[model samples]
Target: MWSGDELDLDAYLARIGRPGGSGAAGELRPDLRTLYAVHRAHTAAITFESLDVLLGRPVALDVKSIEDKLVHGRRGGYCYEQNSLLAAALERIGFEVSGRGARNRTRGDSLLAVTHAVLVVTVEGEPWLCDAGFGYQGPREPVPLGRPGAEVQQGEWTYRVRKEEDGILVLCLLRGGVWRDLYAFSPQRYHPVDYVLLNHYSSTHPGSSFIGRVVVHLPGDGVRRALVGRELTLLHPDGLAERRVVGPDELLAVLDREFALRLPERDAAELVRMYPAGD
Candidate 1:
């Protein structure tokens, strides 16, 4: 059950500067602390990048390697990496974290590609659905379970869950009280193979948008992304700003000036060469 008990908790805590197994005494619910640890562990550890795609490596699912990247290499991982680690941590902390399956809403997106994850936790005799792997756009708090259409607020994104016909679990976000599609899921529960097949399509497959651009979502802050030769866009709480760039320099500038992420001179030239559009 603990896939990452092998992962060094001390190292993970040190990497994030949160007390890992540290002393404290208060009304802190262990399960709730488990959730908070996972959130901090995930955000401070993983990142959003196409480095794996560019490097032609299949996404890996080992704890040691994940820890290497999270604690040392300054890398981020996708859902399975982040959530699996969370599951391991919860299991270690004596909380039950089960793996669940979710679907992306995009038309024609492979159910396999759409497959996502969530965790079910029982806190003080009440079950709660917890997910911290949906980076950038994630819930700041755990959504209560045993109820339909319950809302949980992270910071900016407000999320709600609905269970529909045939046991289909729909988890969504509220924008103006209307449910907006974030993803729908089933409690069928997935294993390693389920994730393995899904990860393949997410990183490959020419039709997958993940491969067509650089997507760096900074969560409640919104998204920063660039499509090859098409556009570079940034979203804000109030509005959106976008532009078309001639090449990499402009794109790098956007990343720097807009998102405050600095791209090295060589890396900027490289991405531009890879995604040149009309002159």
Candidate 2:
């Protein structure tokens, strides 16, 4: 279980910009509308980033730590932190939430480890894929798990879930008229301890992509932006992407202006010091 009781539900709801008492006499029902609203609000408000990993800090999965860093501190986090906080909030709202480990398919055809953490929330006996992480290319709202290969439109972005022959469910996006796989996961369930183990490798291991560089993503309604190392890419709904290099001097500004993320002074200075200058 995700320790929902330990989370500050009111604080979290406010952090995501969801007005209190909006759901029928000040109670959040565990229904599809609530699921969609909470999921959308979360992805819209919180960004996806791996700064703590790049800063040599531990990424804690506990709900309190997650709430402090993300909800209260107004900072962004990677999959483990983002989804864990979201799972806790949803669970606190009386939704049936579970965790799943997913493989990164956008990198290439090579077999990758199951390192990504996602959540499955059951609303009225129907399972929905509620992922608040996965960067800019991820789905903004909850995707229906019961219906695979059906297109779900979220603003300008379009996404679908395809069930593979091996019983794996792959989340795909329609980009530039082509179906692109974002990530895939089996039906196997994961737990908080499992994420803690995965987070250790991602935050410390040299083989981890987030170890040596800065990566941040903001999946806006119209424009999805991703900053990897010094390269900044903006993805449009029509499948057009614009790329540019963000200089070290402008890194913090871009993060604040574009992603709405402002790190602590010490952490920001350290990030600039560790930022890669050469290609």
Best by TM-score: 2
Off by over 4 Å in 1: 20-29, 106-113, 221-232, 236-247, 250-273, 277-279
lDDT of each: 0.59, 0.90
Model 2, 227: alpha-carbon shift in Å? Answer: 0.5
TM-score of each model, paired residue for residue: 0.77, 0.96
Kindly report the root-mean-square deviation of model 1 from the true structure over all alpha carbons: 4.1
Compose the digit string of candidate 1's lDDT tens values, residues 202-246: 778786556756654334324423333345544443334455554
What tens-digit string does per-residue lDDT give for candidate 2 at 1-279?
A: 999899888888888997754463158888898889989999999999999888878888888889999999999999999999989888888899999999999987989999899998888888899999899998899999999988999999999999997789999999999999999999999999999999998899889989889899999789999999899999998899999999888999999998999999999999999887767
Residue 225's lDDT within candidate 2 is 95
lDDT of 1 at 224: 27
Number of colliding residue pairs in each model: 4, 0
